[model samples]
Target: MLKKLGVLAATGMIMTALTGCGSSNNDLTTNKDTAKPGSEKAASGDTGLLNGAGSTFVNPLFSKMFSEYSKEHADVKVNYQSIGSGGGIKQLTAKTVDFAASDAPMKDDELKAAGGNVLHIPVTLGGVAIAYNLEGVKNLKLTPENIADIYNGKIKKWNDPKIAADNKGVALPATDIFPVHRSDGSGTTHIVTTYLNAAVPAKWTKEQTGKSVKWANVGTGAKGNEGVAGQVQNTPGSIGYVELAYVIQNNMTAASIKNKDGQFVAPTLETVTSAAKGALTTIPEDLKVKLSNQPGKDSYPIVGTTWVLVPENLTLDKAKAEKMLTMLKWAVTDGQKYAGELNYAPMPKELQDKGVEALKKVKVNGEAVLK
Candidate 1:
């Protein structure tokens, strides 16, 4: 098997001939003259850089970065596929991609199958916001339990008292509650379900923990964050969960979620940062962490962190892999600069340091992948 499958080549990409995962690295370059319009060169390299696949949630961010990076580092070309996290994980396990972006980290059994050298790099931080289009009643708030009940079909109307309870005097319209979900494998769904599993354990079990869930009600499925955002915006009394950026970009109304301390926390860069600050520095090598009911009183209970997948250990293709790591490392460091601009929180200094250490574990050419 060719291994590097599902990677789509961009037309008129103008990027230098990218290397690795079927992209030719030998022709990599750092010249803008080589890449197509909209792509910028970032690093000085001989072979065009190659990276692709995973997480539509991070798609806009990385797409922007890759385009900007191509200006100075035009020699390296970055191509990514928004094929959803499930496909990204599949491509990664099959050694088909240079890197895989995922909102949900890989599990222990998955790590073992990866054979030792997977680098779990959290590039940027964003929150999944509950967006809705209601008539007249704009200020909407929901506890995790309330959200759970809505998704579980327990509460069928937007004016349910459970929802109104959180809003106090806010008048919610008496409308049919329409819940839109992702049709594709999604980390956004994972984050939502994970929170649901915590706030409503009986409803959100292990079976419902991943991307797609079996809901008691029939909800329409949208393809990705963009689709869901559009669907929710156009449909009155419809609600959906997507990265905060989507909500902001789409100009949709976001619900304030109940925090661990019982305060309604609006999904924001600051609140998500507050939540991630509650996470520990010492996560297992597998990068799996349960994010629900965290200790921080300010922490938004529904917050989540995304992970990028790489080879388990350094490999003969270390140089190419380093291109992936270096890009990711840059995404975490400098990437945070743009995060706040895009409504994403920067990783805390503590976690940032730990993440740098974790990057060291991303090896190249049978040697520890260089710093």
Candidate 2:
């Protein structure tokens, strides 16, 4: 089942060590681009150095996409910092980075703070796996109620009746249940909490859903997806929600979560893509849409679309703005190919078209950049 679900083994896979709060400088080779010279070079005739920060959830995909993009446009260098979504938005508002990536969409206040020009461009979709470390347990199924209670600190034992009821034939241990969560402001937290709120609305309130919540005062707190995954990997009886890529990268066990359709679906490329169906139809003009707890029976319950945050009227200089828009145009189009290998679902054709249209609105001193 795991192999059929496309979960890669950890044996020969090499995990790239990304810095927690700084830019990655991994050396990559360059390739030639076929785009017109005007779009390729900055107006000032200087190299374009674009800096971005945010969302560890999309770090794996961004790493590959940026590296591949640099390969084609050697004159443009993108330095992305994986310091969670909140930090990315903060940097974007502060005008410190050329752009930012986030799993969660910016709030109304955030938009106003950035002069209300920020555009949320949907780039990729992915699932948040309920990763756990338990001896002799390979396939674990969890219902929404079970998950709510476990995270709320109400279900502290592995052999609790609620958990045991779901797995009748399995050997249940009496170990203490440790729920891990992100210590920093995280878009992964926002998705999980939002799903929890949707799944068990009575238990998980709307007030408790956001990039950072007061996490029920239980479990341990880790910094990023890497931190939560590492915590679950090292601590027995520990469970945490992380991106599907992290789960597969660490070769950790992920639970099959019960979706709104009453089906327990595992996080896989197909399942995550299934959740993304019809998302474009509901997305507003802003392009900020949620994919969690979608209605498909085959859909993974904890799926979300990650976006790149760029201002419609860029704050950067004309030369840098042109380069940034060009890079973004390529990302929503060509950059999507690298998503699946990194455990992310590429944006649907309709959404990609919408993204291209939105990118057309990006301007440098009232002049469009794409043309």
Candidate 3:
């Protein structure tokens, strides 16, 4: 259950303050790679800077994309802040950032607040991995009922009968189970909650679902995906959720999830790719679609697609708008090659073609930004 942000009626000054809270200035720079003696620089000189912020889930991927993008396009620099999805939407609604990235699509009300002229371009697909820190528990499999109950403080011990039923052969420790959760507003939370709600409708009531939800007063809370991962790593018998990439990079153990086909599936590039296949068939004109609980036997249960939020009617100065659109176009096209290395599923060819069409629609004043 994603929070449907209401009309943003904040004044210009308030918007500026909100923007400053995340990044000191809009025009920030990252590492630069010097050009070789014979390499060609970008066509334009002093192309204005591009600024964006949002979605820690996609931050790791963006970091690589932006850094590499800078190496080739020295004339323009892109700066993106890895704030939570909520912060990104706030900045976008306030019209402060040049663009925003979100793992969850913006709601209808959010679109209305932006003058109904925004575009959600699909960027990548990933799974919401359920990672744990159980010593000697090499493999773990979780059911929707168990996951929902754990977060709600119902299942308190690692050796609980229900858990033991799932892991028949593994040794069960009688240790207390700690459930770590994201304290900040996050798209990761939304995806997890959405999946829980879908998989266990009777238990995960609508009221208990959101990007920010009132936990069951159980385990401690951490600030970001990194914080949750760190907490689970340090605290034995702790379980937490994060993007699939974090689970890999942190060397944490992830549980196999029971998919719609009644098969236990682990989160991997192949399984996440299976989930994205479902999204490909049903994506709408708005490009907002859910990828969780897909029907395939191999589809990971908690997967989601991340998106880039750009204004349909561009208002930036010609140079900045041109540069921004060019970079965005490259992000969906050439930049996709970088996704797999980071455990993100690149948009399939059909979706990539549609993404290209969407980016092509971005216009300044009245003319198309790209040919």
Better of 1 and 2 by lDDT: 2
Off by over 4 Å in 3: 1-47
Q: How big is the positional error of residue 173 in model 1, measured in Å on the Cα after superposition?
A: 2.2
Worst 10 residues of 2 by lDDT: 28-37
What's the distance in Å from true for residue 330, model 3? 0.9
Ordered by lDDT, highest first, the candidates read 2, 3, 1
The TM-score of candidate 1 is 0.81
Instruction: Report the candidate with higher lDDT, 2 versus 3.
Output: 2
Report the C-alpha displacement of residue 156, candidate 2, in angstroms.
0.3
lDDT of each: 0.67, 0.80, 0.77
Q: Best lDDT goes to which candidate?
A: 2
Q: Which candidate is the best by TM-score?
A: 2
lDDT of predicted model 2:
0.80
Select the stronger candidate by TM-score from 1 and 2: 2
Off by over 4 Å in 1: 1-46, 112-117, 280-291, 314-318
lDDT of 1 by residue, 1-371 (tens): 01011121221222222111111111222211122312321233323557456786776566556766766565567766666676677666765556778888777776677675567777777788888878776667788777877777888987787777777788777889999888778888998898887777875677877876676665688766767777887787788887776666546688877777878777766777777766754565545545555756677677777777767574435566666667777777766666665666776666666667787776554566656
